[model samples]
Target: MDLRIIWFWMVGILIIGYAILDGFDFGVGILSLFARDEKERRLHMNAIGPVWDGNEVWLLTGGGALFAAFPVVYAAVFSGFYIALMLLLAALIFRAVSFEFRGKVDSSVWRRVWDLAFGIGSLLPAVLFGVAIGNILHGVPIDASGTDVGSFLEMLNPFSIGVGVLSLVLFVMHGAIYLADKSEGDLQTRCRTRASQAWMLFVVLYIVMTIWSWIGSPFLFENSLQNPLFYILFVVLIGAIVFLPIVLKSGKMGRAFLISSLLIAAMLGEMALSLFPRLVPSSIDLSNSLTIYNASSTPLTLKTMLIIALIGIPCVIGYSVFIHYVFRGKIELTEESY
Candidate 1:
């Protein structure tokens, strides 16, 4: 197999890992904001505190893979989405800070401030990430010089906004299911109820976005139709999402979470299939678009990275698996809890 394709799969896998892992992080944070009391808030925070930072490693790994394998795409995307990425970085930074500071002061006022920061921090990234994906799918103004030519705000079209909303709702649902799994008593019931509500909202948004994507960018569906194998993945993705609520209602929290995670993987898989060969589609001129062949580094570089990744990625995965296994099951808060 070509190293280019190998590296592309590596990048995609890392992204999927991040999507499944950090997704719940945002979900928990968003849910925490609506907690009825400090104890409930503490429960929410503790539910994720053990694994949230570890989940972030997937994100970093994905970015690093992109930089190593497709430096041009990395540069083009980062430079184009400069402001948006900065804002995301800011949110993540402050959110991390809130984890430590939210409990530092005994006063309710200080905790409230940090709690708001955590929610906004989590919310911004969730929406912005979807918007970024929307812009990519919708195509951005990229010059032949391989640069994003549009303004930052230009990424906020109606299509992207819709996608952003869907992302937010999707994460909320994911987080709710997680909380429902890890919590008991009234809190567990609330989590389940919120998960149901989020799922309903997600179904509506998903329908709207799918329709909009089909109408606005018929090529997404058309191109998928051209690929028989990928079309199957598309079907499975839709099936998993549609079946999510059923699983939730059946009291299968673990299976429900898997379904949501599968949906994320399948959706990304579909996007990868749609955008295969092309790295970033140029709105200015389709000819100016970046492709795997056009945007990737030298074969030697790719080969070297593939070798390193084959060794390192597994270790990362092993560590992630170990961490999750160690932290598995319900969360219990104590005086020392975050």
Candidate 2:
């Protein structure tokens, strides 16, 4: 009913959309480094090629929504996390170049460089994204004017670093599961093994980070738990985590991968729920925090954007689904292929 709540849903949907879509693409890149050979790596790349760029549209929309609908939150977040965001942007650029140029250059040396770039690029975003979220959860230092006046070092604390690694590992695992489902032969087996290994590490890291995050900054969990919906989302996430390994071990790769995607969605949903109202949690006081009320655009702007988004998002999603369905199944690297 309220424009503020509408804006909240709009931003939340886009944020989750980006995490679910680009997330696997990053995972594919992580797996590329461990692929058995060039051909295997090519298969990994091919599996994501048809939709990777399209998947990125979700990210663009998410950023656009923030800038349009919630300018204050956008300003504070982008400025506070400017350095980290810049690094992420750079990594994304390198990743795009690595993807395009890696195949064009026939030389092994050139391809190797791209390969390394791809790995680093994937890793940096995965880790940094988690850290960014972690920092927000921990509450960044804000001044009397409600501006994000925190130092760079303050953002890179131990808690954020732990969350960063957790993000990287989680996405890598997510990618591996997708590859196993879409690929066959030696590469598929390798992906499964890698996914299994990543799952083990992810479980350990996720638990530790969750506990530490709550202990170190109880407000994140406490605020979230105050809402019944938050607990519901948490249960769904936990269930997905429990369900994934069983599906994988049962040799249902497709189902397992689908469940993995759901798990990612659930986890992101939990974080969003945890951080609701406060876009950038203030370490100082609740009154100083940037909530949906303080951060959103005017009601007229919000209403206009809502109408446009309702029309636009579905079209983008429809096309993405169409392409994904058309390109469903394992990628075959033939001489005729791009």
Output the number of the TM-score-best candidate.
1
What Cα-based lDDT does every candidate model obtain? 0.87, 0.84
Regions more than 4 Å wrong, model 1: none
Task: Give the total clashing residue pairs for model 2.
Answer: 0
- 196-230, model 1: which lDDT tens digit per residue? 99988987887788788778766566566788879
The lDDT of model 1 is 0.87
Tens digit per residue, CA lDDT, model 2, 131-227: 8888887888866676998877888999998888888888888888888888887777778888888888988998998898778777677677889
TM agreement with the true structure for every prediction: 0.97, 0.96
The 10 consecutive residues of candidate 1 with the worst lDDT sum are: 216-225
